[model samples]
Target chain A: EADIYQTPRYLVIGTGKKITLECSQTMGHDKMYWYQQDPGMELHLIHYSYGVNSTEKGDLSSESTVSRIRTEHFPLTLESARPSHTSQYLCASSASTGGTEAFFGQGTRLTVV
Target chain B: QQPVQSPQAVILREGEDAVINCSSSKALYSVHWYRQKHGEAPVFLMILLKGGEQKGHDKISASFNEKKQQSSLYLTASQLSYSGTYFCGTASYGNNRLAFGKGNQVVVIP
Candidate 1:
């Protein structure tokens, strides 16, 4: 099993509420990513971090922002949640070596009301 | 750019076989395969680097053709546990970001 974890395996909150999704890894990987996916749908990359203090927006435009304060922790925050934000958030990490496989966390299922 | 995956979905019986294809417009440096069961995170299946590589473990295997910038995933003698959505992520040269294909859903039944 991958040593990555995502907090709040499931969450339901009202619209306009501010929320943060937490992701942490124990593998000491240099690259981490956040992906948004709907049930049985394609995964859309939202954000990624190459290492601590280095973050970038992914191909998919998302209202969520992330910060990589430490190598082991990368958290995503939304200023205000919306009904359209309801989806599954997955956290993944991989070694900096090119062409390496990425390990994914269990993912957090969020429901916006 | 996002790769294109063929046959959005497929169904197979235990002991049957199937193939899923992923094609990219960009020059690919690597191709990563992942499988995600319902309501679960995607699990890494394998990765094929450039130079026309093929790798397999058990009944599952994949091939990558650098010249064509395409990859094919082979499922031989499938099992029930193989039922899940398979995704292909492509990485271009000098780019660390991986662009993913939509996904291919596979259902293996007994």
Candidate 2:
């Protein structure tokens, strides 16, 4: 079945370290998004891509950046990690932004020391 | 802006019923619902579009109120499998982006 996948279900990194969270979808969706959530907190949109070569910052200001070089892959990178960056990062994809249900990946839990 | 969900948390016994509401200040084109177990990704439950369409899986139904820019998920005869955090996502103006509510935690004890 078509699905979204995120690598490194859990990650532990030290401060100032660089890390990349990989998200890939087999559904061939044009719209992709990344969300951050802390325990018992609401999900916050951090980054999104409309299509390949198109990326935008989301409602929440995040230190991470994402690239959409291919339709199936949307990866988020943190140039420098911090304790505050520790949270669950969720990846989602939809056929279109106009109308459709999003499919989410298992998610990556990052622990920045 | 994020949508508001009522009843931050609720506990229910098996076979009981409950309703979770999601409201948005902005006009909505569609509303989506999902359930997430602890440490798991949120799974799509249903979606309600404009024009008063209602949809969901077996026993789990939902309704949308276009006028109120809100939606409600109704759980009838709850089951242990239904115990999880429920979230409502609203998208407006055909925007691909969805604003999700904080989520409602539901626990069904047998």
Candidate 3:
């Protein structure tokens, strides 16, 4: 039962609202990532963390920021949400030794009206 | 840049077979395969390293060609459970980010 988890499976909020999507893993993974995807579209990496206190922007630019205070946690926060931020956010984690495979969370669906 | 996938969508009947190809413009260090169903997280299928090896699991196999910068996933005797969007992720040497391909949507019907 040990796996990555995401909170607030679904969310709906107005524009200009602040939101944070929580992601955690119990598998002791050292690397974590955040990705955004629309239905039937390619997933775009938003942010990633290599370990505690290490976070970086991914290929696709994002308005959200992430914090890696602990190896088990990596959370993405949007200071001001907008309609453009409405998409499925997926969290993933992987081991440091071999980064080939990644374990993903159930993902959170965000709707900004 | 993201990798390109062939056959954007495919439909098959039970016990049929299919292949999904992913090609990148740059050299590949590794290839990761994953499958995601509707409204669910993507599940890891397998990973192929740069040595041009073929890996398999329960009739699902994949091959990586380092020189060609391409990888192909073969699903034999497809089942309903295999119906999902399959994504191929590639990473270069010493790179932390994974460049994923436009998913190949597969649907298996009875």
Candidate 4:
């Protein structure tokens, strides 16, 4: 019942197009994160939110921007998509407990041509 | 900083055992393990805290060494379902921002 969800499991957009990846969690978690990963590679954190109205850039610098308007919603937007932006985007959520394990969404695969 | 995983790939037969190691350059507060199937997001397996203890999930187990800033995951009596990419994510200040290591691909043959 309680879980993280990502919309548009797969997306194919042309370069220069604006795209938004939607992430929502019903688990009532206070911490949410977005990670970008390539096939067979490690996941790189691109954005994170401590709570509603709180957003921060992650360790890996990304061209995309994220906004947290509500506790359950965190969306990532790219003004001009590029081929290099094509990758799997994963959304995760965790409670405020320092040692709590995070739950991840199914992920969205974006492809830019 | 990102952690480093050893033995990028390994193959094992059903009922075999294997160990994957992950080391971080910075002091680690916790180590998390996850398994990702082909074309899917990773599923959390377990988390080991700073006290250097072991945690288990089914036939999978892991140990964290806070002093060494390292962790090791062990799979005993492997099964076909265990075939996937294993990733170790470390956090210096708990779960705020995790730095993942290069995944270790495990293939368990029947």
Give candidate 3's error at residue A88 in angstroms: 0.5
lDDT of 4 by residue, B1-110 (tens): 88999889999999999999999888888889999999988998999986679999999999999998899999999999999999998888644676688899999999
- For candidate 2, the per-residue lDDT at A89 reads 99
Stretch of 10 with least lDDT, candidate 1 chain B:
B91-100
Q: Compared with the real two-chain complex, what DockQ does model 2 have?
A: 0.66
**Clashes (candidate 3):** 0
Chain B TM-score for all candidates, comma-separated: 0.97, 0.95, 0.96, 0.95
Error of 1 at B93 (Å): 1.2
Considering every candidate listed, which one attains the maximal lDDT?
A: 1
* lDDT for residue A28 in candidate 3, whole number 0-100: 90
List, residue by residue over A1-113, the lDDT tens digit for candidate 3: 43999999999999999999999999998888899999888889888888899888998999999999989999999999999999999998888523458889999999999
Evaluate candidate 1 and give its CAPRI docking class based on DockQ. medium
lDDT of 2 at A63: 88
lDDT measured at residue B62 in model 2 versus the true structure, 0 to 100 = 95
The residue ranges of model 3 lying beyond 4 angstroms of the native Cα positions read: none
User: Which window of 10 residues has the lowest lDDT sum in candidate 4 chain A?
Assistant: A93-102
Q: Model 3 chain A: which ten-residue window has the lowest total lDDT? A: A93-102
Candidate 3, residues B78-101: lDDT per residue as tens digits? 999999999998877776777678
* TM-score for each candidate, following the candidate numbering: 0.97, 0.96, 0.95, 0.95
Proportion of true contacts reproduced by candidate 2: 0.52
